[model samples]
Target chain A: MIQLIAYLIIIVLTIIFLIKMIPRKLKKSPPYTCGEPMKFEKPETVFYRTLSNILGLKKLQKLSTGNLNDYLLMIFICFMLLLIVLVMV
Target chain B: MLAPYAVPLLICTAFALPVFKNEKLIKAIAILAIFLSLSFVLSSSIEVFNSGTKVFAVSGFKAPFGIVMVLDKFSSTVASLILFLSLMIAAFSSKLVKERVKEFYTLLLLGIVGSLGIVITGDIFNMFVFTEIMNIATYALIGFTAKKEGLEASFKYLIIGSVSAVLMLLAISLLYSHVGTLNMADIISRIDTNDIYLKTIFIMLILSFCVKIAVFPFYVWKPDVISGSLEPVAAFFIGVMTTTTVYVIIRIFYTILGIYYSTWFSIIAIVTMIVGSFLALLQKDIKRILAYGSISQLGYIFLAFSTGLAFQGMYHLVNNAIIEVLLFLSIGTMLMHKKMMEKISMYAFLLGALSLIGIPPLSAFFSKFFIITGLLEKNLFIYAIISGLISIVTLLYYMKIYFMLKQGEKKIYWPIIILIIAVLLLSFVPVWLQIFKGVEVDLLARNEYVSEVLRP
Candidate 1:
């Protein structure tokens, strides 16, 4: 445990020192939209949509649509599943 | 000696808070009430640790007849932890909660009183009552703002929570019919684990608690609930509320039933872990992400318990509660001071996120390490590996929040600072002290608990 703490402190200090030692300069760049205000969707919306699609969670996400009926149905299914498992065991 | 007074003191204070018209006084009285209760809990914990289990039979009525509050090492530790967090949240909310001051403080204290009762009560029926008390207060707190979204979320929670309550009541009734007593110690002596009826009853009870803890399939209400509630209130829900429910599972499975290590239960926990983590990754809202993250952490605790790693589970319970509270309160600070997000808020969130991801020398790291090692020892290599991979997913979601934070101001939030220190100090706990030794032993020693509570 002592060794672990020592290593943690060392790692943190090393990162801080490395960051401080690195030299960098800030440069202003033109807007990527060519001076037009970009019309784009919220990044989180697009990211979540794509990820959900890739993971095939669209059905699961739809089921959890915050509807009262959907919530009750899920509860009912879970209860039945629990009952089945316990009885079998 | 003061163990029995903790819940009633909070209850009386909660009722009395509304009489005072001054909001600052109301907040002060609420904080004072929690502080007094916390002191009582801490003193009782010291006594219990020094001696053994202490049982307080209500109104001088003995066990199997009247409700009793049992203060073993496990209950004392958990109760103290809950009260401490409640005290922190009470202080934090003093600044955040501007409207309905009296109602907010009253409901917060009442909710905390219910959680305290759940942790300390010896009667199964009494646990159910406290669970309702906590849930009702939680529902009110969630809808305290009375905004459309808040009311909608509270209504959904109420619907699902009522279903859980009915299931718990049904289980309690079945158990009473079988064993003829609601006293947990007495039921332990009478219950036949192999009996199918009793098994069904236990399953009902466990399923109800799983919903309360927002395990997968029943976790749909959580994100909305967290997103809708006031941030400090959300912190209280994620930190104290779910931890207390997990404690109920521990007390029931380990002590009342004396049945440990269920493969089906472990499978449920694993599924909850995987599903919650993945769903968290796909969330856009910070509160929703933390809600799902909390669900995944609950899965870790359940899995630890099902695998017979009671100590590891309890340790992780404490660590997870602290980390969640830290993160939520920091986010609350950021939301409050949006124009200038404090540097302290950023550091607090980052530290909490790192700790949640099980970074080295953090408290959660040790708990996860012990749990994975225990799983490996049980030849559950797949479970161990999945648990490890879930940590990476945890990192991803937390980083999503990290990048969203805009830090500028040098102002400090004392609560977040205190919590950050608490998280750092927690990592030093196991090595520097043996606080959990008695709790770990007491959890597995079902016969000892029974004999203590049933002693004339």
Candidate 2:
């Protein structure tokens, strides 16, 4: 359907634009060693990374004024859809 | 000829999206069109309410021959709710929406126009078209910002919405095959819907509508979309759109489906409330909390409708519209503050949360009482218990929020407005019993409402 094609085109183009624009807005730096970009030539494994001392798992859990509103809102709205499914049943 | 003006007007305005290059002219036109559309809604709804039903043959075609726009008590009731709230929302937008004003207002009008069309049209195919219109507007509004969270919420909504729309279209297609027509009344009355596929279509519609209303399970998208938006926009939909969609569900289920046969609906209503309340308790985000709160509140709509108390159901619906407007508006107002905004909003949030949990004298408490009593009167014991337990859970979570906010020194006069809601719903009970003739009997519902939506 034409509508389906339009939807695909719009979504694809938007995603492409987002990928290009967002990274351009950020400063490029050699990625940090902990989060270093894995080379395509050599495959990376979780066990390998742990043994290689590349990533610090505990470092990710920094103390901050956590804002959970956005995530919680998503769950709440999804619940609405579930309610609808129940109603339809 | 005149029957389709609402949808046509919206389409025309939307078509100009490429022309105006901005939404200003279209915004002005939208306001004018709504005022014009309100007249039609008022006139036709009034006629239907008084005479029972009014049928307009679209372009002079009759029944099976051509599209018919029928105005029944249910249709008119919802039309009044949608238009009057829309008018108020438009007025609210004068202050609320400033950035991207043209596009925002156009989308707002488009959504309203779609809902209006859905309420007024008697054709199933027409309903599908309007659903698309309404759904598109919501998607645009939710995705108005490209923030990561905003886009994520919209993406989630887009996926669920696509599924529901597909199911709805399939159901409509199936109905068309069976009846060889898309007119609602004709299909219901002429065809033997006892077929298994009839059940399938019913399930599909109920699924679609539940998503629209943001009831339990399907409600996950509402908190994100509503709370994730900028404050004023959140207020607009939180205050109006979600409630309007619930009204849409009521109309579609009871009137369109003519589903007076089963208590299965009551069961679903109970589930939405229980799940909603439990979820609300676990939420940390103020908006997500409110979103869950709304889902729990809608539980009452289902409870009342299943009890076969139509007036009671309508009463709860109207009460919610008022409460949400006040609560969200206060939130919007508090957010407008500079230094004390964070603290003040926390307090306002408490007021809203407390009211939602049925704190005494809050509109929610009294309205909730009416629902419980009404259900008990109908001997729906299990439903009343489930609904009441959910209320208790609501009370617990709301109290928690209230204490948390009270811990802060900076406070606004949130109680002054909170008390206002209590008094309003309290007055409704006396007014309903005719114990107080303070206002005209006709305005018993409208007077309690702070919003300018006059059903008459």
Candidate 3:
């Protein structure tokens, strides 16, 4: 319990220090945009879109279009693949 | 004695809740019942850890003939954890849920009862019954908001969940036909591990539960369900519901079937981790991101279990539950108050996200550490490296949420405060309680569980 308390104290102190020391202006700046105002897309959108394109996961994501029939087909295909793999092993 | 009463007490309370028209009274009854149930589970778990396994046969019928509830170190701990999460969610929901208060509490109580039954019961057929009960309650709860999206998500889940239930029942029937018994211990003692028919049965069972836990190819419906439901209900699904399903998988594969490792399951786990993390990166909705995040976390737990690290798997399971619930409830509170742009909520969200990313000195960090070490010990260097990479991916997505957060009014939510404290205190569980040693033993020692259940 003493060790736990010590760890907790360290964590609390670290968080407080970081919060106090960081400049408020820096902390509040909108990420990935210049100081000048312009139309800005969400950083996550840009990052993930590039990553997905690089990885070619766009096709996979398209397959998961929230359509019930597509979901059922995916389930069937996956189950069959798993069944075959396990049975062979 | 008190252990057997926990499920029954909740059932009785659920049935009695509809009689009270007053919402406040109904909420009080529901919370009190869960609190009392949690107490019973805690007392029982303490006794179980000290004295070994305890079995309670229904109506004095012996095991292998009638239903029995086994409170080993593993089940008791899981039951206690489930009840504790339920209690916290119930309390949090007291103010969040507005429509059909009686029905909401009733379904919640029933869901708790089903989750408890799944963990505690020793009969395979009884487990199927409990799974249905749990799934039905969840179906209703998901649609409780009565919105178009919520209704559609609930309907889709109902179709998928019912199909899985049918597969589970069929698997149970096949096992019964092969072994001529429904008791887990009895089947373990009498069955052959290398038989082709038995292997098929095991696969069917695994696939059904894989859907429930939202593994790789089966996880598509989960984000919709989480995004459509109320925040507290979504938290329940992520924290209690999925955790209990994982427990069922562990119990069946490790304790009953006596299969310690599987290559295929490891492959599935790795794919699940990659898919869930990458998908989460693309999501803009907070709940959708969390939904995929949880799927990624479950993959880590599955990887541990499949690699024969039951202790690490169970440790990560507990950590994942606490961290996910903390995130869901805190975010839920922010949405409820229309304070999504608050700095306090952002801080709370960061705490959970960092923990999920396996930052040092946090509870998940230790579990992830144990899992990677265990993987290395088994000479699974490739799996270890993939797990590490997934952590980086986890951090990237969570950082996306961090940067998206904006500053506004800072208001405190008591449930979020309590949960944040819980997440912090979880780091001490392994050192302070020292119960994981006993749970590991209980998981690995198949004969001990078998003998205890079958003892006259």
Candidate 4:
């Protein structure tokens, strides 16, 4: 049962990542843009501004081409570790 | 006798090659070492095929407790092919490297040693050690040119490959903890299929090797590595490097694990095929196109495995090695000159491309036919159909490259002519003889493999 659940979770996460990545790949987003369209403007949201602050302007541009999702990545990693521990235990 | 000498001879020569300052002598020794190794493996392969499995008990120790080498039909066949291909690549590219010739040839020979070790080793831990050796050599080889793209590609491959290696080591540790054995045959004898621990270990090992073989999610580094490396180096990577990884996969899942993860392998194979062919279709650069095409060809090998066609899969594996080496070498020659390809080179490329498409009369067709037939016999119509359809996609991309080729009147090189002749001979062999018919009997006899290793 646990194996099935683990497999399903991986499949779901992979599907979600693929959903997010296909568009960026199709558009061939430039580096540091995270798949988001570039425009001349200050940060529109606190999320964007704080992220840009942390990563710097250049990396923010690369990340915005929309490849990285910090929250999901953390969740996925945690889930994998949990699965490994569960299997081992 | 030759089985025991091949690896040591290659390793000694590899280390010795870099000690010499004479470029011409270094080149000669490198070629001579590879050619000699090729002959050694060839003689050993014939002996093994004619008689039975040959075991080389290392340092007066037998299997289970000692490091042993088993030259069965499978290992001998693949190892011989790899050594032969290494010799060809070495001879073909001897003059291509203008700088660091010694380091280049040294790493090349060492890499071949690693690959040969992986195929012949009976212990799981020895296999991992060899995997690392091969990977490290490859990492250096890819970055040898010191070009920006080569370094980036090498770095990327290193990151992914190191993680996979760690995973494999962990899997080995887990298996040892449970079975108290590092010998693959002994582990198989002790494995408990019902235990979740064993199941997890199985999954871990499969995933690790899957990464090595670049199945789906783990394939991100493949295109970059192939495109970034020098053409002959890329040929070596594509042709023999990937073949050894798949060999390990087969040895583990089919031989040691005794567990069939056919569904997962099938899913991975189908996805890899689709993604590879589609990406190949989209590429404009010649190397990138061939890289993606090679990825697609890997998918076909796994697809055969998924259908329980181990022999047929190996047949495809052999075919892919020959065809990819031919295609990469020919295209590489053309690209090196930056001129229109000679008519013979074009014909060679066409032969490779057509063979890859599974055109009848080519040796590749028989392998694919057998795989599809096996699938159909098992009522796996969907898989059979999917694989069949994927061949068309394979042909389409190959045709795109075919049309892109610029015809020239220059003469093809002698080495390339030899490769073309090799392909032709391989293609015609299946027509007149049932030489490979024994592979099925050899591969599926699990009990035979176990007894051969355990025998005093």
Tens digits of per-residue lDDT for model 1, B119-166: 989999989999999999999999998999889888988988999999
Off by over 4 Å in 3: A1-39, A42-45, B1-19, B339-344, B407-410, B429-433
For model 3, the chain A TM-score is 0.44
Tens digits of per-residue lDDT for model 2, B1-456: 154355535544765556765545655666666667777778876665455456667787766567766665555656766666565556545555657776677777778767777766768788888878877887777777666776766676676677678767887888788668776666655555456667666666666667666665456566767666655456556555666566556655554455543566677678778766666555556566666777777878877766665656666676666566555555554444531334544544565566666777665676677778877877777777777778777776565444333232354443324434443644456554332122112222222221211112
Docking class of 1: acceptable
lDDT of 3 at B326: 80
For each candidate, how many residue pairs have backbone atoms clashing (under 3 Å)? 0, 31, 0, 13
lDDT of 2: 0.61
DockQ of each: 0.41, 0.03, 0.38, 0.04
Model 1, residue A45: distance off in Å is 8.6
Q: How close to the true structure is residue B375 of candidate 2, measured as C-alpha lDDT? A: 73
| Number of the top DockQ candidate | 1
In DockQ, how does model 4 score against the reference complex?
0.04
Instruction: Please give me the DockQ of candidate 2 compared with the native complex.
Output: 0.03
Flag regions of model 2 displaced more than 4 Å.
Answer: A1-89, B1-36, B235-240, B338-355, B359-362, B400-456
Candidate 3 residues B365-393, lDDT tens each?
88899999999999999999999999999
Task: Tell me the lDDT of model 2 at B379.
Answer: 79
